[model samples]
Target: SRYPNDLARYPNARITFEHNQGIRERRKMRVNGNLLSSYQRQTVCLLGGVLQSEVSGMSLKLESPDKQVVQVIMKKPIEEPLEGLLEVVGEVTAKLAVVCHGYVLFPPGMSQNFDMETYNRLVELMNERKEHYPTMASC
Candidate 1:
């Protein structure tokens, strides 16, 4: 299911568990072709992890095959938070193909806010429709 040959310019765009998870949430309709993104109806779908506060340099930009841009900007990159984000994306890719990848679009250091209640609520919202996942066993 991995389209390794896709040449879409995506910085921090990794089709890892993070990106795949998001893909899972999309709705698969065998239409004649892909949908078009109009300039007025622009929305950036996010499917990636968050960065830690200490790390600098973060960004993510996705251009559609037709050149429509969808970007998700974040600060730093945190593994656990990203793990959580991808899990949510995976659970919902069936209906939303827009959620492509995740990245940071800020300068210097920015707060992760993983501990913030508001952010946690958003994560919860994403994972709300998500299927429960069992923790992987360590070898």
Candidate 2:
């Protein structure tokens, strides 16, 4: 009934509908340290090695796979000692720092032989071709 004549004309055509909940959700993009400035004010996901952590200050330093380091300001003080590789999800600030919403810590030795350069390349490719990746597409 919604498309009476059109559905009859294209009998085999498939129709897909998307529902919006009236809330705008920002999509998180995977990024490296060097690309932080470009995504200022936007939320992003960063994978890096924990360089240093200041629990008192609620901040920490991370070194990306590309070897670029950046500061991450946490929403709350760290409750545990963070080490090894960490994946931080947060919004980027004007000063090129991330205000972390949450993080995941990879177990030690897991990242001991991790190849960062290749991973960084993959991130770049995914961002460059967001349309090809359904998860990355805005739609």
Candidate 3:
């Protein structure tokens, strides 16, 4: 009944819903400082500790899970005071800097218990097994 014309033309034909693959492909992939250059110009999610902020509040230094420090440039002046750990959604530039589109600040005290080395290992594992885990491949 959904496709009345198609049903009328072929009464015995089966109808099935097809998912749009493009939607899943558009999700931002998670990456660390070491992986930034490889995903240049691509939108991605990066989690890091805030090392320093510029006086203009348009940029800051982020220490990635791998202990590499990279610059993060915001599309707009930062409205909130940045501290501790933050997750940035942005595109990687040619210079390996992240041009932030948006970001999420972790709650106070959360960073004290966070383990960077373990998280880095997990990221590497997910990337290595991307083919086997279709959902994680997008992260």
Predicted structure with the largest TM-score when compared to the true one: 3
What tens-digit string does per-residue lDDT give for candidate 2 at 1-139? 4232524443432222123322125577888877888898887878899899994959999998778888999877887788777877778995458987666565565568778889899888877898875332111
- In the range 34-99, model 3's lDDT, one tens digit per residue, is 888878888777888999999898999999998889899976787667888777777799555988
Off by over 4 Å in 3: 1-25, 135-139
For model 1, the superposed segments whose C-alpha errors exceed 4 Å read 1-14, 19-57, 73-139
Model 3's lDDT to the true fold? 0.71
- Please write out the lDDT profile of model 1 over residues 1-139, one tens digit for every residue: 2332331332333333343353344432211002322111232233233322223333333332222233333333434323222211111122223332332332112223333345334434433433452221110
What are the models' TM-scores? 0.24, 0.74, 0.75
Q: Kindly report which residue pairs in candidate 2 clash with one another.
A: none
Question: Where does the lowest 10-residue lDDT sum fall in candidate 1?
Answer: 30-39
Candidate 2: 10-residue stretch with minimal lDDT:
15-24
Query: For model 1, what is the C-alpha lDDT against the true structure?
Result: 0.29
RMSD of 1: 16.1
Please report how far candidate 1 places residue 7 from its true position, in Å.
Answer: 14
Residue 54 in model 2: shift from native, Å?
1.3
Q: What is residue 132's positional error in candidate 1, in angstroms? A: 30
